[model samples]
Target: MDPLSPVYITGCGAFLPGQPIDNEIMEDHIGRVGGAPSVFGRRALRWNGIARRHYALTPEGRWLHSNASMSAEAVLRALEAAGLGRADLDCLAAATTQGDLLVPGHASAVHGELGGGALELASFQSVCASALMAAKYAWMAVRTGEANCAAACAGEFSSRWFRPEFYEGGALIDTKGRLAMAADFLRFTLSDGAGAVVMESRPRPKGLSLRVQWIDMVSLAGRFDPCMWAGASEQGRAERDGGWSRRGPLAAHAEGAIALQQDFNLLKAVIRAWIGVYLDKVDAGRIDPRAVDHLLCHYSARSLREEIVGLLEATHAMIPEERWFTTLTETGNVGSASIWIMLEALVRSGRVQPGQRILCIVPESGRAMVGFMMLEAVEAVR
Candidate 1:
């Protein structure tokens, strides 16, 4: 693929409802919501790097924004930033695991919220890496001449999926002594947010735009079951006696250790493959890891990020610590929206200058897929 073939990002936007809520607020609400009150939520917050997060619902438990509504807001802002309108959009690609319904899809939900249109629509259920996957698909569409311009968006409403009962249900007798339930551990880390980007086939001559240099995605579904899952286990179902459990919890089974078991080797293989694809560039003295100005990564957790970073550095990729960035502490883990949200924040922060390079990686717990994208900033007008 040509580096300057256009299929670049022209605009980006994000929607985070309400103000930042600390662990204190979250604990207070958790205490009143369901089952028994436990300190797991607060403990999870302390264990993770998250100090605060944005929630779509009020602390007192009022519904504020649904997935569709938040996504619509983000899409509108992105279109406006691109100097385009809804009618100008040729395609709308959405990626999300949590939507209003399981049938019509989140893409359809967002499309309907945008007022039914004839644009090409697609919905992806790629878990945490969904938005990045959507972006990759949109880039492919533009590169293949299927669409002149497309919007890739993702909306995540994690608040609704959390089950307070699950948090207080399980008790750990292990040495760690932490909550044995996934809900207890994940409640404080997951958050609600939406983010989007507008990509065009034609690159702007003078402005901040991300050119699609290269993208690679690989899924390891067959190799591992999802560490995080939403449905109930067979053991749980049978224990409950053929009926449904209202507070069906989303489980994060083994946490980071399971992912680390294979990622170290997988990442090495990915690096080798990347070198092979760009070997010509490297031979011609056009490739340099030190030239990478930014490392935008998915917000899984602080420890996981550190382990990955260590691996990257050990592999002779000299990624500067200051240049590496994420939104784990400020926004929690917005799942699929994490990638786009981090990108939007970086763009708005004005840290990325013209001609700089950015390398982003999306790591999902479910299916254990890793997506890689390398892009170059063209120009900065603002």
Candidate 2:
């Protein structure tokens, strides 16, 4: 393969486990903490605007699929859509917020579940931008002639963390007799799913292909404290004594450190940071806001949509509302898997035409990181 050849995303696949759980019935599945419904769940559900979402668990809160299994299923579907098989891939890249095991990397776990010949592998762990980072790695592998065919995937088994058992006998209520935001916020927002994309040196023989133009990623951790995190106390006490490992496991669990937490106070800063990054990209000539035919943004919640739009317009880097695409309301926030799932849906909608440009933006509030990718839809080389 020529080193100068362009890399194309020939196929995309997404797998959302189990049936769609409606907002009214969510407590029935995940169960109510403290043997009663949370007072904040209804308000949170309304604010997030997520009507339905899928989970990798049954009504009794028993897990039905592991993160690796879901990722493998998506990979198989992507390979099939690309008219290829597992043996055809030369590289596999995977991303997730957390895997089933803390020892082996997520890519290794996915590869083990996929069960094919040996291949190059990479794993990424972060909030929302992890999937795009994995895609960037796969694209580089194909573009640099290091591989002929590559697949990048992201999966989230977030439902496991939201189950009531995780919070059993823990302090979840505040002084007002309501569930604390730190423990209650994510329960209504997150869901479980996986998505994958196949990239190759050449486009498919007879269909639309997304030619990779550029992928840019940046981290602004220096400017912000941890906004979303787990495995540590919300007060940041663990950091002063080395880290979470310094605290005994029982102590950490009793302090509710193992549960996911978000600092809602920092959300505005996070959105502003995302807009600033977009403005920087425009100023550097890396992107033209007006030329973007489609904009897929992973904002994690519908409540932030207006704020993001306002910021974009204020910064003069606005892509019109008509050009925006999102599935947050229907799919909930699947963290790192969201962008890939959105891309797969857009490509399958049959609305894209040759020469169309699709821009993807992923903002991660975990220490404020963001990723942007641009792709041009092209006709396959027949």
Candidate 1 local accuracy as lDDT? Answer: 0.70
Off by over 4 Å in 1: 1-5, 30-39, 163-180, 234-288, 380-382
All candidates: TM-score: 0.80, 0.96
Q: After superposition, how far is residue 84 of candidate 1 from its true place, in Å?
A: 1.4
Please tell me which predicted candidate would have the highest lDDT against the true structure: 2
RMSD of each: 6.3, 1.8
**lDDT per residue as tens, model 1, 1-382:** 5543468888888999888877667656533334335545555565577877788876556779889989988998888877788888888899986687868888888988888568888899867777778888898888888898899999888776453333333332134444344445666677888999999977654568998887767676665444454544423322333222333322323221111111233434443443343333435554466787898878466756665655556555556789887877888888888888888899889898888898877777655666777888886444
lDDT of each: 0.70, 0.88
Residue 257 of candidate 1: its Cα lDDT? 17
lDDT of 2 by residue, 1-382 (tens): 5447699999998999999999889987887776788877988887888998999999787889999999989998898888899999889999999999987999999999999799999999998899989999999999888999999999999989887778765555544445577778898888999999999988999899999998999999888888888878877623666245678767777677778888888878888888888888899989998889999999877778888886667666889999999888888889998998899999989878999999999999888999999999999886
Model 2 spans > 4 angstroms off? 1-3, 173-178, 237-242
